[model samples]
Target: MSSKVSLLISIILHAGVAFAQGPAFERTPLFILEKNRNPENIMVIYTQLDSECRVQKKRGGSEKVVFDFYWLMKRKDFKQVNPIIKKEIRSRLELLPSNDTHSFSVMMNDLKELDTDIKDFKLIVTANKKKGNCVTESILKLGESDQNKKVKLESIYAESKGFLIPTVISVTVNGIDAETGAKVTRKYMKK
Candidate 1:
């Protein structure tokens, strides 16, 4: 009996390497706006995905695949004022305001002139290899501000260098308010 078929092929190769080492999928949190409550006006975003690369395609035959994700981001914010909720949260985050009651006092004086440490924002992603055609990138480093009331953005950092064959790195967090642009809390990271 060939030693029970070599112990059933070594127990099916150790159960397929324990299911390929498991744990590598489950990320959700891709918002542009929609969460609010008010905690000195809130905003916290954090993300980190290093060295991930992937590519696959069958073309017109079906079974599609195409993903390119490189990531990094640590953005924070807190603002409280009211100039009509800081002109509708700077027109829905498009920012760019030099008037209108100084737009939350120039974004809470640029989060009190940042530099408490942790600073560097940049994240690039391109998807279509399944998983809802993802697309998210927004980690501004407070390069401009001056319309006042009360604003706070506490963190920022992002980096990437992994592309060409196996990608899946995602992290997301959100909280915004200058008065009422909404979205006060959000989180996502699992992969």
Candidate 2:
């Protein structure tokens, strides 16, 4: 009887750990930009969300929910590619506006448009920085699979010299279901 009890406890512990880890998601690359200018600068950003809701009762006979958000950033030199690094820093400060409402979807669309215009410029090429300021927002919705399960996400981007670069990403998970929603995770680097 004791051996059976021990095995049962071990199984329960392992199941708890697995449930804590939540569902799995893969990272997706979004954009890459290449510039041959003096003092080139490159930036990349990533964001993710994890959450779980349990229907367990506490000692007081009440249930609770849990959620979390994570964000990360990575940067590299422009000279790493085939082109030699020109001047390191062009303008002392590359101003990023704050008024525009930037998001992953908007940035994706803007990048597509910029890619077309970039082909036209040659030698000392300068792409127009994104116009206006930058803004971020988030929203959450429940899923049909589980009443306790839901997905939440937020996206942010900036306009620089006519080029739109994504900057901030936020995500939220809720409810009892594991799978949530779709998100863009790719990094943009200039060639």
Candidate 3:
């Protein structure tokens, strides 16, 4: 084949591959759960989780979660906090030394309400132990509801270090939030 024709063929093939892969998403809503055994006092679980987005209104759908957590010990120095979502620290629950297993549930909804599209967001859980800190993270994603009759939901686990118990982070394409300045606000659970 002529060099010109070969070049044209190569370009066509590359274009086809690129188109088949679909648009690049900045933050994907998939997560893989990671089990950390270093700090053994904390456990986190997600219940009643859901996410949706309304493109026409430029408003994101309600992203809600039932955050069930358990702290295995109670001490004067023991600290358990969700710093990202909860800004203020209140009455100490661990003022007195006790062996009681402390557990509580956090219900946070309306996490990703933005003028632009949000692919997904992450919920982080961290537990403070005398030995070290252990972290658990979960991610939520929203898809086209009307277009796809059945909205697919699945769970994947990932490992990362950062943040303390019951924290949330909203993720969007850089372009989307640049102009709108819209962000997700976290609701703290009543103590």
By TM-score, the best candidate is 1
Stretches of candidate 1 above 4 Å error? Answer: 1-83, 86-88, 91-112, 118-129, 135-191
Which residue ranges in model 3 land beyond 4 Å of their true spot? 1-43, 46-67, 70-108, 115-152, 155-191
**Residue 102 local lDDT, model 3:** 21
Model 1 vs truth, CA RMSD: 20.8
Ranking by lDDT: 1, 3, 2
- Number of clashing pairs, model 3? 7
Q: Per-residue alpha-carbon lDDT of model 1 for 25-141, expressed as tens digits?
A: 312122222222222222322122212312223247433322111111121222233565445433323322222210111121222222322132212222222242322222222
lDDT of 3 at 2: 67
Task: Kindly give the stretch of ten consecutive residues in candidate 1 with the minimal lDDT sum.
Answer: 15-24
Clashes of each: 37, 31, 7
Instruction: Give per-residue CA lDDT, model 2, range 64-115, as digits (tens).
Output: 1111111121222212222221111111111222221122211123333332
Across 65-93, the per-residue lDDT of candidate 3 in tens digits comes to 22322222221122243663123211211
Give me the candidate number with maximum lDDT. 1
